[model samples]
Target chain A: MIVIDTWLYGELASYAGEDAQPGFAQLKIELPDGATMQDLLDEIDLPTELRGITFINGNLSAMPGKQHDLTQELKDQDRVALFHLRSMWPYQYRQGAAMLDSFNDEIQKDGDRGIHHAFNG
Target chain B: MWFLRINMKDRTHQLTEVPEKYKKLAGRSLTSNLIADEVPPLAHPLGPNNKLVFSPGFVTGTSAPSSSRISVGGKSPLTGGIKESNAGTPWAWKLGRMRIKALIVEGQPEDKGEFWGLVIGLDKETGQPTLEWFDATEFTGQDAYDVYPMVFKKFEGRRVSVCGIGMASEHAYGNAGVIFEDMSQNPSRFAGRGGLGSVMGSKGLKFILLDDAGAPGVEIADKELFDEGRKKLAAALNEHAITKPKGGLNTYGTAVLVNILNEAGGLPTRNFSRGRFENAAKIAGEAIFDGVKERLGEERYNHACSPGCIIRCSNTWYRKDKSEHVSCVEYESDWAFGANLEIDDLDTISELVKLCNGYGLDTIETGVTLGVAMEAGVLPFGDGEAAIEMVHKMGKGEPIGRILGSGTGTAGKILGVVRTPAVKGQGMPAYEPRAVKGIGITYATSTMGADHTAGYTIAPEILAVMDDLDPLSKEGKIALSRAFQATTAFIDTSGHCLFIAFAILDIASGYQGMIDEVNGVLGTKWTADDILELGTEVLRVERKFNEAAGIGKQADRIPEFMHTEPLPPHNVVFEIDEETLDKVYGEL
Candidate 1:
């Protein structure tokens, strides 16, 4: 079994059940080996739409209206963080930052080269 | 319109007709162009040859939404480069209403120790500005928080606004900021980077009080067109999800970016040692929102920083007893003292912000300086109490305090810390350059040193048409950064807050509304292309001045530490080459 270290921020902290703090919640969830991001979401019962910015081991995997990480597999001891919809990382601040291969591909295929305030997919 | 020049050497003032050349310029365009034309590039930033200029943006005093911005420009004591620091305040609105194109302070008092206050009011008969000088010696050497209310009471019963410097400026600290009064009369709003406050202090000026009662309002060339543009911009601001009522900004303030950047591994932590902070969530905008609700026993929305800001993004932090601790803890200020120092407590962060506001120091510079101090073993990281004590000593002008007050670059050198995260002698803001390569390019190449706002993102439609540039490539990123910088220059000149860029970039009409409003006021036919061209011209003028001041392209490189030392989380160093860095300003 693999234990995933997870964090939920803002209003999403309530999704962590009794482990939730005022502003954030952190929990370690034991999951079967080779579980994907979808399975982790199902385990936590956090609706996919509720998360805006998601990071897997500190690498951006998804943004609001752009969720390409559902099928991306999670590893043991991996750090996963989820933020509420109101949060923003403007394009200029995140232009050449690290991102999941699937997410970077999605951005490259976009018409404006993914230079937007928010993507409505 | 008039050009009011105050000669500090003799305490005399002159009001002249606005020159035809300057009539079309306002805000940063006016300030930068005026500085380029008048001030000698090689002059010592604090010397007699350096002049400080202030101008309000176009449409500032009109019915435009969120357009209360003032641009303060001079040679920077910190960077030794041309600088235009901006703030949103009613002081800018008042200046615009008085029809003063620019207020320039020139020459310096021989004594240097004595300070004078300048009271500017409209001459009822002539409809021109009148300036009266007073001995402001008594007001110096005190917290600006204490001085603001006294200045307001001194001009009681009039429509007045106050702008002053604090103890930091009085001591000629390189990190000093010019303090402007907020809506609540607190000296919290600031034109807070590049050491413009020290320039003002060096001129022997303490306060500039504007009383615009009975003054004619801003002249709109075409009222109908102006109203049309204003309504469009207002609708965009009201309808946009992030900018609407009770939206991201109004709900949580600019500190909202804390968790976002932290999650993306872009937040600078512990003197740029890492990209992520363990306690980032605790110090984020969402945390501020929740903390305020828990303390005040109710959910509280943010308030406007200036008179006409619809997307009010300024939040207040309250104590455990429900009293106001501070009017704001901006994202930069919060991160500078919080995650950057490894402090997770909101109360401690608010106290540091309040101290910086009172002492008139730039929060980014102070926090980064403290980070370097920590790296030097002057104090341990996460020691909030020690950090607070150091800030107090800085305000008191103690020897150690003065060393830190010299800013990040100077402090790093003095303390023998080699990993200083500074570009052009100014400390970097909340964003880690190594993690975010485009912002790194901006920090390295911006005429103003290490400014995040220097290259704000604009409309993707505008960007899409830029010759099929792929944002992932080095050339594409440089082109994009140059375009973003030009767009920011235009917005800075428009008198609207840079926050407007958030809504306008997404809504097409909102972008047009900005251009139309400027044309409505100036009666000039300016298209989107003209906006970019004008911004480019402003950059050229600034770059020319910086080059002459000995900060040429060679100085346009990120710190050696950022290039060699990899940031954790992503573990990426700034990989953009020098040739690409030059292209940011080369093609311009």
Candidate 2:
């Protein structure tokens, strides 16, 4: 079981209880075989457009994907953060995408996806 | 450009040529310079000794895009120090076109509640505006929201822009703000900090209406160069991701900061008792965007608050019955009244915003005040309905309402809230100081007293508009905050909207385009270093005034509670030492 200590937002937060703490809602989850980033999203059940940006272990993994493909493989001990919107600026989105693309390439290249490689924060 | 000086004590007005030393000074720089030179810093903010200065930025009236802001400056009743608050509206553009650089209002009426108004029109002798003051006692008791019809009716046959206060300001609320008519002619846009409106109201001045029927607008020094710079800046704006037509702010409004701050554990919740809100996304930008989409015919998004702003970030909300509720609600306003109060209902928060606008109160200060009131159990946490009810009383000047109107710092003292989230007698903005150390430096060191726009380290720290720095880190924040503050001081004077900084900071051409346009109009060759120098001079002038006002390096402080209390998610206090914080204004 991997630690899924993340809270929902937007419409999903509305469905979550008033006492459903917003950030870092700690819950252990089990991922099935060959589970990708898309699988974790499907299990969480947030809408398509509402999924503005996402970060795994302090590094960006997905964004408002109406204009881009962001599906990636999931790794254990990855602290994932979900959001409904990032910014209106395209460059900010582009830079975030670049960072995530590189992070994913590292996971594939070295087979060691550490938090240090993802983010220092 | 000329300075319009109005003596409220004798009810006389005059237009004077700009002094040689002040030819290049305008907007925030001009306001600060005049206040430092003229107004007695030690004088009571509400007394006759204090002066109110309103001026458009250097590029305000020209064809420069997103450059139509009016700076309102004075010694603040809220912070008891120097202050400059501004807003973008048609009101400022009209001032710029009339070649009126600044409007200085001084002195006070001998009689109590003897309100007055100033009307400006073209002088047949010189083709410039002639200023006149008249009694405006009839509209004294009305709410700002309801005074729009009366203003339009009174100026029925004239082409003028009107701005003033309401019952809150008239009653001398410390958190009061000046109200201006937006593009929709709604009394919406505001110079909404430092209780400057109370200073105006205390002078027995209700409003100033500028009618520019025969005005030729501002003259361009080098029209060709101006156009070139304008084109470059426009291209940079249009091409950029954030400043593009339907970009982040235009789509989500400034409320976009909500989720991002929350994700970073910086969204101040429950009056800074916690770092993040449990229902942040419910009242965030995406939710607002979605709500507007659902109520498309009833509600609309992407409206411009100022006439020439291309990145129309302002939004409008309406009831299901198609009645307009409010046009736009911002991040700080929502966070203060919504998350800080533990009230998640967006519609309810909007209603509260309407009350703040109606009463002419600073929503951030008032919301933080209300949160402090809640901390003392005057109002319950998460009680949206009760919060709205209390808002009505503020304008009415009820006993409890007056306490609320006094601003968050005073309210905290009255309520005995030890953990009050205020610095230098002003409440903090949306970001929690404990969670975001860079902003923490800004909140402590800004001359204007805990104002986010005073420095806005968020661009680099969180939004990544500048080079990415850890929001939670202390390294290089003092220098970063000071540099941004200096740039912001200069930008605030240029009459350009501060949002331009996002594009200018990110795109190299955007920054050059801004400086080139200012120089294009003035026919002066100023490098980027010169702009930074101008910004530094503005801060120096303000710091000088603040020093005389009894605010010095000692006054540069966050709340004691912030220094002790550890905010959750990132369990950190405001750990940046006082010595380093003091160094923020070192070069300036």
- Number of the top DockQ candidate: 1
lDDT of 1: 0.91
Error of 1 at B173 (Å): 1.2
Error of 1 at B291 (Å): 0.7
The candidate 1 chain B region of ten consecutive residues with least summed lDDT is B460-469
Which tens-of-lDDT digit does each residue in B419-532 have in candidate 1?
Answer: 898999999999888888889999999999989899988676557436876787898889888989988998999999998888988888998898889999988889898888
Query: TM-score for each prediction?
Result: 0.98, 0.88
lDDT of 2 by residue, B446-476 (tens): 9998888887321222222224443223444
Best by lDDT: 1
Flag clash pairs in model 2: A88-B248, A89-B241, A89-B242, A90-B241, B57-B495
Residue B501's lDDT in candidate 1: 83
Fnat of the models, one by one? 0.78, 0.11
First chain TM-score, candidate 2? 0.55
Superposed Cα deviation of residue A115, candidate 2 (Å): 21
For candidate 2, state the interface root-mean-square deviation in angstroms to 1 decimal: 9.5
RMSD, candidate 1, Å: 1.2
